[model samples]
Target: MTTTPRSPAYPSSPLPSASPPSPAPSSSALSSASPARWPLLDRIEGPADLRALPHHGLGQLAAEIRDFLVTKVCATGGHLGVNLGVVELTLALHRVFDSPRDVLLFDTGHQTYVHKLLTGRQTGFDRLRRAGGLSGYPARTESAHDWIESSHASTALSYADGLAKALGLRGETGRRVVAVIGDGALTGGLAWEGLNNLAASAHAGPVIIVLNDNGRSYAPTVGGLARHLDRLRGHGPDAGVADPAPTAGTLFEHLGLTYLGPVDGHDTRAVEAALRHARSLNGPVLVHCVTAKGKGYAPAEADEADRMHGIGILDPVTGRPPAAARGKESWTSVFAAEITALAARHPDLVAVTAAMLRPVGLHRLAEAFPGRVFDCGIAEQHALCSAAGLAMAGLHPVVCLYATFLNRAFDQLLMDVALHRLPVTLVLDRAGVTGPDGASHHGMWDTALLSAVPGIRLAAPRDPATLRELLREAVEYADGPTALRFPKATAGPGIRALGAMDGIDVLRRSPHRPLDVLLVSAGVMATPCLEAAAALERDGHGVTVVDPRWTHPVPDALPGLVARHRLAVTVEDALADGGIGSALRTACAERHITTPVRALGLPLTFITHGERPELLARAGLDAQGITRTVTQSLTPRSTP
Candidate 1:
């Protein structure tokens, strides 16, 4: 979505005569030429330092902060566009309200980088989104100013509601709770729930909801609410009319909130005035601030697709990643190509995404078959139930989402799709230990959660070929709900199957030596499992590796295969507890198989941010780690 820049009617009067605002900080003010690029930004150690700046100087400081953000975030990689958009808004918020005590909560915390910088965490940007460095989203441990830590969308308002209630009960009536929710976040059902509760509980202190309308989520905000917001903003300064008073008949006003201006989010003075007015209300208020997602920066502003919402390390000036990092075929690309091809072949096939049309690879399908793709806006639960409806009709629905986000729609998937035994295929991208984005962003929990679904068939692809094959299989399976999950990493070369036993694809076999070990590889775990098998063979043990393309339901031949081997180990890029390994173990037990079954996967814990390989190795799911585990299992141990 292209954001139309608005020319706010800033005050035309000259600076005051007494206590005139200081001029923008010059480079000469720095102690040294080096490490002093952002002289104005360098001065800000906290919100107090920012608040101390004069009004005129704040504009220059905002520019410096944007420059600082681009320089630091481009090198480290982060939510650059959103943060860039909120520079002045964040400044205005900190200036008008005292944080830590006032309680400023940001929905979809990726937009909190500016807030982080103003809160004395500028130095941490050097290692932004890295292991043992700064987290991508707000972390409660990072600073007292950061109250909540969630990257998930549509959660901040609910947090604000609860915080407001707690503050009221504690008799801390002076402390205000502000929730800065985006138009994208507002589309979710939970956000409406919070709005409903906040409106109903008129006694639960004042809550200033700053609607940061950047006109986009991963794409442009969709549905009825977006149109309503557009209507509210249509009659503003951009329309060449006088700055109107708080308009009535707004969605917020209808919900019992005092509706403030569709104020220019970039205009510090206007936003500050609006926030102050909101703070004075002593009840629920909404200050709708219209912003350009990639304000100021030429490259980001010009970007049509997502406006660089999230990015890898890139050249700040060019706003382009290095050649090596560019055009690399990822699992998402594979799915995009396959899905587009599939859509063309099947006229009855349709796709659905939860405000992540582009991120989850449905953009290809949407482009190819325009009317067939549905953009459900940050509402995953609604997406699934709607998909269930689509299935109940005649069309086959492929519901695509990030594996982490799939957690939000579990109940819908179970009751609506699986219970009805509808033909729905869930394409779960980033389905395993996704790196850098941290614990909340990781897709490691999907396999465990999906395993609990009664009639859901889950498939984990080992490579691009298998991904394409399995996706077609999943879409064609009209028996029940089916899901195809893959990681965020590049889809490497396909692993050629040595043979097939029932439905399992055997990748490796030890012919000469006796059947000693069976290696069960799930999805992309085949590569590492093969390495482990080769290592075991060198250590004088017969090892066989297999991939159950569809991992759920426990392949019929699996228990029989396990019975032939002395030990059976299932390796997956998912939780060890309820993952494919757990399913296989149960299957073997049911068949009275005597072979010892070992589940080799991620531990039941919140995995921190790091490189995918490093995290996998640390969890003993890598080739070296898998080999070590097998070797240890083969070795004799003395009694303690």
Candidate 2:
């Protein structure tokens, strides 16, 4: 199917009639084993092929694509529900606009699986999100059709605004710039900033903003904007009997952009018609497309939590993750239980999350203390600043977020919380080399970033026991801000400390030997450090392994301990520069200690997607790699 080339000038043409609808296959037929023959899907390899097909064949092809996604994505453990929901929407977008020439940008990009399928990358799903394979989000290296490689939300509109402005400057006004943003991404402050700017730019070419309102970001969306969208979609008390008119002075219209729809996103013809109407308009236009997250799959739609927004390897038929994947107690679960218990004891204690009540393990706190926990939407910056306000009111607020997401609120953490010396505890989950989600999702930058914040104390728990102990210590410390971070993996059995000294825990020691080497472990790195120390001891070298529970302040006893040992090495899963290792090296230098200090951690580069163990090993942060590094350091080189 080819697109009709439009004139360079803006046209005031009427909306064209939609094609006749085809008979949709039954749910049973669609869900039954992958079809031996996907006649329409197999024949189409690109957008041109998709546009060439008869309009009546689109429904059957969508069904075939869903079945293909279920079989492939389930086997590889990638995003399922979001991709399933956007099948028709993606089809409508591709059908209406020429992709490469007319830029199409996805907000979070996880919903682009259908776009990948339509753009001839269907076979890459077999290795989805694997190292050196197809990324879970859009990647520029993979296809020309994908404009931005985005996983973080609420930034697509800003990108669209910039691209539209650039195209207008180049006299390429005929090229369209479209941004599809949703999954509660509009709740972010950045989205509003982009919207405000886009509305202000009256003649910045044609920028079509597609609002895919699914009414959820992890759980149902929160706050006033969600309510406004709900009313616009005819689901709230403020909505009257009849649907609102396109130019009824709605929020988008007031913001200076033309408003259209509350269109049925599942209907291919309807969404296509709405998009066509949007393209015909001049300047920026907003098309509100209402869709259901996990629309077709019964299991995903029935999932009360997140609508299977993300999943591990799961049963294709039942839509259930494997028993083993669910049975393990993860770091998030441990924090959930401990935080809930802590909330019961402290009435003045409160919690906040950035539209991630369940994902960051604040659901339990929200359940136990109904009014105490706040879902601040996808606005991390707002969450941090608001937590500071809570602290000012003589209350301690614990803000829970994924370590990667905390990057968004650094200015707030530094200026509002640390500068004011407020009693706010930031609990960061997934604080290390997060696997499979790719570079953008890794939680590797928190330590380096947090180190620069004055008056802030950071803790890296070694195990479940330390996580529980440090959490209580952090909340009770009323002098300044504190943060506790842990990895995304399961919290294994507790590692008993051999002894304690000045807030540091000694995990292992060489028997009856001089202090030849000191291993300073940060949080979850204790296990591998202990293993590497054992290997050094077996080779007849004295080694000591210790976990500095609070890694940021550089325990008062650390410089002296480094002074006693012949060599000191710090191990962490965070970035090497400005991490615990760098801090310790500086501390020893200040105290006039002569011992050599070495730092071991992830390099300052975008590590690709892979399993946790595999990625760690590649970065030389695993047990074997650590042992090798230590041995190599001890080997003296001849005078050059």
TM-score of model 1 relative to the true fold? 0.93
Give the deviation of candidate 1 from the true structure as CA RMSD. Answer: 4.9
lDDT of 1 at 205: 87
The per-residue C-alpha lDDT of model 2 at residue 395 equals: 98
Candidate 2 residue-wise lDDT, 464-577, digit = tens: 999999999998999999999999898998999999998899999898997889999999999999998888888888899999999998999999999888889999999999
lDDT of 2 at 43: 79
Candidate with best TM-score: 2
Cα lDDT, model 1, residue 547: 97
> What residue pairs are clashing in model 1?
none
Worst 10 residues of 2 by lDDT: 2-11
Question: What digit string (tens of lDDT, one per residue) describes model 1 on residues 381-480?
Answer: 9999999999999889999999999999999999999999999999998888998898998999998999999988999989889999998988888999
The regions of model 1 sitting more than 4 angstroms off are: 1-33, 235-248, 635-640
Model 2: residues with Cα > 4 Å off, grouped in runs: 1-37, 241-248, 636-640
